[model samples]
Target: MVNELYRKQLYFPFSHESRLEMLVEKERKRLLKQRIIMHIDMDYFYAQVEERDNPKLKDRPVIVGADPKKGMGRGVVSTCNYLARERGVKSGMPISRAYRLCPEPECVYLRPRIDYYTRESEILMQIIVEETKAMVERPKFEQVSIDELYIDVSSLRSYKRAKELAKLIKRKIKEKRKLTCSIGIGPNKLIAKIASDYQKPDGLTVVKPNDVDRFLVPLDVDALYGVGPKTKMRLNALGIKTVGDLRRFSLDFLKQNFGKFGEDLYLMAKGIDLREVVEGFEIKSIGKQHTFEYDTRDLVEIRKVLLAEAKAIDKELNDFGLAYRTVTITVRFEDFETHTKSKTFALPQTGWSTLLEVGWDLFKEFYYASKKRIRLVGLRASRLVELSQLKVLKNETRRF
Candidate 1:
């Protein structure tokens, strides 16, 4: 009996389930030691809002943007539901083409309701801030155009805490907004942002720091943030397709070819991003532009478009709580040649009326050449400082 007991203890001390449980416990503890970041992305945000308001639009292919005009309209798609995307439609694609793809398409081509969306965004942001103990950060430095957000959940180190917070945020957003959001959890902001996109339309993905390599290795190099079309073509020409292929090249080699952006690409491909989530971010500049399907030299049309563009910029500045000290006008000729002319003001200003007056004045002075057909018009505001930080400039300082 003593010999049999000794053999049992030596050969099968733990059951299979018990061993698996031990492995899971070890992994969970290991993950808890690292900084946990989360990225929350609303699924088809604009379309979802439209759907929520109108129940008849549910489960249907909803396209939000400019009117297709039966495959002859100008402008680009802003957002589309999953059902529309499955039919070979995507954001930024020509609205005309979107109409061509969808069978009996339910297209809603209307101007974006800036005020309504702003209110919704504020409500969702408030919910995130109030519920979670995590440090919330936004991509407002570039533009408040991101439909997604980066949150630092490092305070919630334990897996249990992180999971609970994620669940709560998701539930609250859905309950309050009647919309779905996908969330990604990772060790840093970059990984979390990428992970959130891995699964879409209501996905929740978590990637431990140690597991980042396993997941990122197979993704395309272009999948990394900031790798635009030009960069993607360049990387593809060099036989660098996947993130794994990019990893083969040294950081020095990448920098030599692509300059500073190349170095950033190399680090990002290796899943190494250390960007911090900053709070109370502000915009540096505000601008608006439109591409015309047909080039024309009509001054009346040009002035109309410029006024509308100025109003859009004004709206954006107001949303960001910023004021501009300079106004710029850009014109593109039919041949795709572009030139910009700008004027600086002594006082900070952002009202739509003021911006339009400045824009019209600049256009009249700089746009005397009637020989060339105009293809595009743009308005820009710069030299921005937050309204709260404004300081009056003295008369001597305003001479410039």
Candidate 2:
């Protein structure tokens, strides 16, 4: 009878698992409250760069992308300033469409200065790293992309200190580069990533541990990272519209449907994320690219750019004591069409000659495919392995 009673109690809607979950969740919130993470995103990065270079374009709508060709260009806009956005222009929109949307006489369209942008990025990254060193114990810096990063500053142990650091970083960038960025602070990467975009250009938003649930529950389920359109459709089919609704489902139900991603969704709905900021030279790949001043079918210019990019990538690999077996090149043509080609070697390569030869071959293959007038060219080295690890593996194989 005792066993039967306990079995019935376990079968009840509010079971021991539910009670234990509440306690576990409370403890999790308490622990997470102590962590401090920051996500910094450059606002209108490319467009802002152009604006800074030419102060005359500051107040006017500026677009940093391909020529619109008077509403006939075929390519996409890489980025635009907020003023252009207010007039219905957007990134990734066709240049022709952007011209049609804005349809104004004063909107300025400019080609992307890839070299100039790269120099600015190097300078800004240096400033950020230098700022972190000024702080206690040099925080973890995770560069997510050319213009986004995550910093773990839990060592500081105070929100006030974190904000001060963030402000200093921003002030330094403004002073040096005349650029603005948006920053978000949270307990983990997910919250920090979302919070950074919660505001617009040059904004800062913070989310405390206790406020995590309140901040996330009312938002759309799609707001959580990794919930794509297809996953969202499936979630909506189950009447899970908001993050709060998603919290009601059991992990088993989510797993039965979404496999591992379902578990992630369940945790995210409750404002739980366990990810760390990876420090320097901790990247899967390194790359360099160039956007031409004008579209051209000339293979000579294309080859030169590829060679330069290869040399740079090779040097970066050597600096990191890393080797890569795969090389990829991306080409955007005058008509705004794009294509990418990749080649993988049996052994990881660290030689400059090898990188250039591989990069040139990849470029030749892509150039011959359509022989289109190239607008932009980029090369990347991927599938990396540390030199030490490669050496260890070779020694082990020799014994065999």
Candidate 3:
């Protein structure tokens, strides 16, 4: 009888515009219902792990990366604790600068131990899986990185239950690992990710479907996913400094100015993201970058850096049992302008020689096109294929 009544209502001879409005409203309601995604980020992961191992380093500023050769090291900072941040040290800053900011007896500087960190990550992942199983019968999980992940618990269909699960996971991680994590729960992945980063170490923020706009509007435009420094500058030029400002522009105007990405910005301004959490991870590419201690116009020196990066990448590809069909080189000029050039072969290639040859060839383009001194260089091997899937292998005997 309820089905018959609903069917009659659907054919009630409503005006075309009214019918369209009703259909749109129905679709919106369906899309907004019962989606529960949670994002978890281990707080200050690398530095936090170092602090955990040495309780004495607990409150002191800890930096985990290359040694600062007394304000002269060439390497970059990997990660630092909040204390270091307060002292103006940040990840990716030059180690020399970090030394100047938080020098000597005041700071606890340590090198990164990839092996030990991997073990700790494995333990944390096990705890995550175990606790997830204990809470939700079946949950979709996606590990974004070693220190970040997403869990979809739509089956529970209750924000209260999801919050309880988040608390439980947090407790379990702290109890077993003596570490803390921040969690964000929202109706979709985009909102969840932003919420997770809303607060710092050991934070929990939840944004319901109805509250997404309110949570997002007051934030800066750059806080939206994929809005990098360059994009933010462009948006700022147009007076779109905040998400609320971005919302005032018409969809057509945005599309006219920004093309395909403009449509994405428009939807993001309204807090609409339809992506789902899928299990498993894929390596899209592998690459390494090096920043020069001083900018230089020397092509030979740049080529040497490219060769070293290629050797490192070759080792990684072999370790993964993969081969690549494309080589890309990234160049950042002294003025901070960055550009990338790529080359794709007819078939996959192995070993470092191909990367060096192709990379140097690509670099000459920018080297000739500009008089700008290069501040950094990078090399990437992409369009990867498994060695087991290939019928031919080239230069397999040669090692970089």
Candidate 4:
């Protein structure tokens, strides 16, 4: 009867073997608590790419984005070199504002070359993996973005070797790609990510387990990940300006005020992040959106904007070597009312054609249903799966 009860508790589709595998995986991940995590962040990625391609642009301010047409351009800056940053130019700043800050002959403005940048990113990632593969049995790596990644070298069991590996990766990238990256080593992802930015351009910082508190305490609470402007203001109101100050509050008190996020804040203040370094790249969604200078009811203009966004997202999907099973379209009216519609496919799709076809249909449904002028248009692809993983799954299914 006990055996029957236990067997009945097991859910359908999860065999006894699979259940045992899940338990084994969970135990393995829990053992990673003592992991040695290393984070790599390329310095001024897009702008540096431009500078590398043109030696003459070195030491000069280079801004890569929409043409900053003498303080009258519409789009925002994609990225700017350290020199442009010194002149108060920032990524995501309006091109008009970027021009105002670092105007004319002083700064070189150029549009983004997405394809070239993607190619460079792929080559750099390959170099990192190939250079470090032989050092340990299997160092788990995760690419967070085109220019940022994390590697788990817990198998090495030495911070000294971790730092050495970081230097080797950095040197190899600079040698082969003419690029520089900053690296940070710590006991977990949160500490490593923050340490990566502790120093600029070419930097390597290591914070051992015993030094986690010292490395985190004196810093402002805003230095903790996920503490944005609003959260900082709330923390400041509670007289918690620094991580040291935050340690004075009780975890229960924090949870009472901020709910689930408060627990994260409390843990961060203690420099305690138990999250493991998940291997491989995993993206929930990729999207692009644009707000028009003026709201209009022109379908031709709307389709053009959607098409451009679809093309950009398609390139991103291709760059990541992934495909999507869902397409979603978002439309915001002039009065700030927004609506979204989505379609999911039985099979994953690649290329912009799918987006344009499904997105246009979804938008027209809304356009005809409502009598409001459109202010913004957006396209998003979700339910992403790596193309290689899909092929493997297909092969396994065929064996059945």
Candidate 5:
């Protein structure tokens, strides 16, 4: 019996039942490996909101940003409707320049109504979250930004399911908020994000894993996220002007030059992003501010106020059961000049004194930079992580 147990079985007789079970397992594995992701971006979100609420702005070019002051505004364009964009106006272009490109009557420049936009965003997100939940349990959703989101719908499967969901989402947004959105579907988030931007306002594009290479190879390397002008120039110098070129570049050469970032870029070129669609988005920073009855230049008084604000943050952070890794000091001068300085730690700290120490260091650095009297000073703690969640992860890690 011992000898028989020690001897390994070289072969087993095949049967119909065994063959069927093996096929079933293979199919299950294939299904389990499937990934379907969608990226949805609201078109000219702020500008669209302006036109949606007021039909009068529909046929006109609407530029949303700072007050153009007829031709001499301080800030830049937040966003512009497609009509404005056609005339060469763009988001982040200086308001003065946008005014130059397309003067008043040619375009209607308006300041950003952030509250209105936020309300609309909230309504849209709530609708999407709830609607997706009805289709899939704990449906993977991530709010990429104020006007962009990514959803994982692999559980639903099929291009048909993705298309139906996209149509439903667009319809829902139009019905609820009278707004339009563009959506893209792909095997992963990278392709989805890129495809979402492929067509203009209110377009849907789908790219499967098999088609990813064909789609990306033709695009410029600059189309890759995080590839700025400098990086593009460097890539151009390396004769890697296109996505395919970057992908086909020598791996060792890239590593010797770019280090870890080279590996990341290589993976990106291969359309392989392993990041999951995370659920909840945490508030990055918590802050407290005060406006004094009078503007005082007293550093002692400023430090005292800073300490008080830090202490308040301590109480709040403690109550919230959170810790922070960044300390930022906000200073606004009587002249309306505002600046903020911050320091980020390698690890999060919860102690009140730690907050005060970092806060003071930041304030002192900025305070001496310009000897102008500080009208108002504030303290903010950011890069927060929940203690309860941290503890849970730690315990789970140990158990594993």
Candidate 6:
């Protein structure tokens, strides 16, 4: 009787392995019906760079970001290896908190060397572009941020063919750069992006067109792009906890709750994304920021921080052959309340003195109101125009 009960629990009344085989066969058939897309993401990019250059650091926990200062430091973690992540350390967490979690004396922490990483990334991208014949989009070389990319392989003949191409890209990148990447193949960019993250640190996942529904059904609503904390809370309250639940709602019902974004959410939950990959992308913004260890209202320290950030931004822009038309300053108060002030100049400026002067003025005029202690300060320059365009502007502005 117990054996019978076990079989009942494990298998349906049909009690045939053929039934299970049929299910698998059905899924295999469904997965073959759509366009193939792929998203590629580098794993622990920065930390891996450190390990690559310094072999001794290999096989040890590595954290790459700003100084930890013995658990009394400010700033956030950029990236940490899987080993460190296992200890509850994560990217974007407070470095101090990471220290508290792992507390290993030998845990390696290193400042980001953007130049080195950019060169390494170029090598990786070259290999990918050559192997897949796919368009490559890159952020500015100097920024060294977001070491992830999307490759549209829909033009490829088959999903199996794309998987073979993905394996080659992975092999070349690993052999040349000594780093690993997780790749996901699907019908659209959204599905590809989601599938890529389903695995990590050297993984490959392929989702054929027919498998999209089953693959997405069990995922949480938060998995949809653009759904933040506030949005997730609202979704949960509305009984939309998973993508399957979201699919049940009519477009009109979703729009009623979320406006146009709701419509977008509904479409995404249904695995409908139509974004195309574009190559030769330019940097949208250039900036530097720092979080303080303690919140302070002292203008003196704040100004110092602003100047340092300005200098860093100036150097970064210089390296990238870019210039900024607007200077933005961000202040985060002790309670996590944040505000930003920006000033757009008629001309681009890369000089440290000019950037600091304008940045200070913008902060004084916009951010000096409250007695709230500031826990973080940041400087950003946006509305970027090329340095060559700045030269043309300078010549045009000169009086005849």
lDDT of each: 0.74, 0.83, 0.86, 0.86, 0.79, 0.78
> What lDDT does model 3 reach?
0.86
Instruction: State residue 194's C-alpha deviation in candidate 3, in Å.
Output: 0.4
Q: 2 or 6: which has the higher lDDT?
A: 2
lDDT (10s digit) by residue, model 5, range 1-400: 1122113222324554344334433433343347889899999999999998889999999999878888866567889999999989988776778999889987898889998788888889998887777776446888967888999898886867888888898999889889899999988788889889888699999887668779999899988878887788988999999999997764456767777667557667767666777866555677887555457788778878888898999898988889888888888876757788888886567878998888888878877788787767889999998977766656676795
Candidate 2 segments exceeding 4 Å error = 1-27, 103-106, 228-234, 286-322, 325-381, 398-400
Residue 328 displacement in candidate 1 (angstroms): 6.3
Clashing pairs in 2: none
- Model 1 C-alpha lDDT per residue in residues 1-400, reported as the tens digit of each score: 1122334444445864344334434443454346777788889888888889888888888888877777877667888888889989999877778888873446555556667887887788778767774433322211134466776767656545666777888999989888888988887677888888898878888888768888889998878989888789999999999899998876557878998887677667767665666554345688998877688777788888988998888887877778889999888776667788888987787588888888878776656755777777888999986766555453445676
lDDT of 2: 0.83
Clashing pairs in 3: none
Error of 3 at 379 (Å): 0.6
Stretches of model 5 off by over 4 angstroms after superposition: 1-33, 283-322, 327-342, 346-382, 387-400
Q: How many residue pairs in model 3 have overlapping backbones?
A: 0
Q: How far is 161's C-alpha from truth in model 5 (Å)? A: 1.3
- Supply the TM-score for candidate 2: 0.72
Which of the two candidates, 1 or 3, achieves a greater lDDT against the reference? Answer: 3
User: Among all windows of ten consecutive residues in candidate 2, which has the lowest summed lDDT?
Assistant: 1-10
Candidate 5 pairs with clashing backbones: none
Model 6 lDDT per residue over 232-311, tens place: 99999999899999988765678789998975786687677756565544678888887876778778998999899988
Q: Write the per-residue lDDT of candidate 3 for residues 114-194, one digit (tens) a residue.
A: 888888988998899899888897898898888889999998889999999999999999998999999999988888999
Worst 10 residues of 5 by lDDT: 1-10
Query: Which 10-residue window in model 1 sums to the lowest lDDT?
Result: 135-144
